[model samples]
Target: MAKSVAPGRPNQFLRNLNSKIACIPMMLTALVIFLGGTVWTVIYSFTNSKLLPRATFVGFDQYERLWAASRWIISIQNLAIYGVLCLIFSLLIGFVLAALMDQKIRFENTFRTIFLYPFALSFIVTGLVWQWVLNPEYGVQGVVRSLGWESFTFDPLYTPEIVIYGILIAGLWQGTGLVMCLMLAGLRGIDEDIWKAARVDGIPMWKTYIFIVIPMMRPVFITTLVLIASGIVKLYDLVVAQTSGGPGNASEVPAKYVYDYMFQAQNLGQGFAASTMMLLTVAIIVVPWAYLEFGGRKRV
Candidate 1:
């Protein structure tokens, strides 16, 4: 009693068949490698895996130990301080630079290249350069002292209290250029008519930007937020190249904690647990924002 397929209807399954077939390998790799690896890491995190992964399930002992460790606690605190400051300063400075660049200034290309040059260098290079620049005896402090001020103090890498800020400086210098470019592109995408209307309405330029332009660039802001947040989460190499978590683990971040525990300390379970916590933190921040941003949209 079932009706046959309609002659006028196109077969949905066969549509884009070649493209879908071509993507099978990539899909399989993502599923088997990334997803599978994540699952494996999460599973072994609950076990007492040391030296190598084992099946000695230890319930949340690894996590409890991780939390109780003073080093881990300091790292979390440092990450929070670093993340908040980095997000704020990077966005503010980048947007300001972008807004200035959008004013049709002379030698814009030269200025942009100069501003963005730091971004072209690797984080390791940036860290090394900043380390030298921030060195008390050999860099800024020395230069200022030689100019007649002997008591000028400017070392941060060796100072436990402000070591994270030293790394933050390097991070901002290396990252702000890219953020500026992204903001510039977003600003450029804004309609000129909007500006004209604002002018005709006697609205201040700053007011127009704050009230209208920024709201329109929501997608760009979201994209930049994701990039910056991801970078903040995996901040390791810069810390290693600059301070190596020195000055009594003051500059230690979550990623470096995970790495040291996994490789140096040979505590795989503890490392995995820390990593799982990082994943959970990212999920907690990202999931709700993503749902709010896209969940209400109707799928085509």
Candidate 2:
């Protein structure tokens, strides 16, 4: 019987090969699309392309021109300021709201719903409403004057020096809700025994939250920060709706600048360059944060 045994068929090897072969079409499609788009963008960025793309290469001249443009420079500066202010304000307000909501007070669900519902609304609508509210002649300014506080002038949307802050205020209105939801989720996941132990040791509630609870929610905090940072990097809608980057481009941001050049100014090369710059900036900041979050975890 042993002498009569025949060679086994290569069933396992054939099956493995067949499985890999089945994935080839989809994998090729993805690779082709990704590489094709990237190559197109790179090629266009080297040319003096217009509204429609062109093939005449003009080297880095567009980039030089973009750097020299005052509006572009102002836009970059405004974005930096707005990014920092929005990030800090949203985090602080959201954290405070979450902490308050965690106190097991009356109508807890109602309070959470009220805080979170703002995030569901469109930023365009939110920006428009804020714009009306901040208008000088008929908004907060008028109301304040009528109430006998004639010195109350809240016209940052029209003030060149303080317009960026107005845009930040609108962004915060939409952004803080997201932060609140995230922080609330983190707070809810904390162990109740931690609170009991803290109370047993006579640890103050605020101290417990600031030191112990916050430290435990590091991952959530990092996640919220990253989310907020990405939003800051691509900030456009609220600024456009609320201020239109105006009162002399005081509220302009990088995304809006890129958009204007790409379409209105018919300077695709410069727009792509700005887009590339934004990508680089995001990579520079996000890579390290992501590495610490993910790579640090793997090492641990």
**Candidate maximizing TM-score:** 1
- In model 2, the clashing pairs are none
Task: Give lDDT tens digits, candidate 2, residues 86-171.
Answer: 88889999999999988889999888888888788887888998999899988989899999998988899989999988888888
Q: Candidate 1, overall lDDT?
A: 0.93
The numbered model that scores best in lDDT is 1
lDDT by residue (59-89, candidate 1, tens digit) is: 9999999999999999999999999999999
Question: Estimated TM-score per prediction?
Answer: 0.95, 0.88
Measured with C-alpha atoms, the lDDT of residue 203 in candidate 2 is 95
TM-score of 2: 0.88
**Candidate 2 lDDT score at position 22:** 94
The residue pairs in collision within model 1 are none
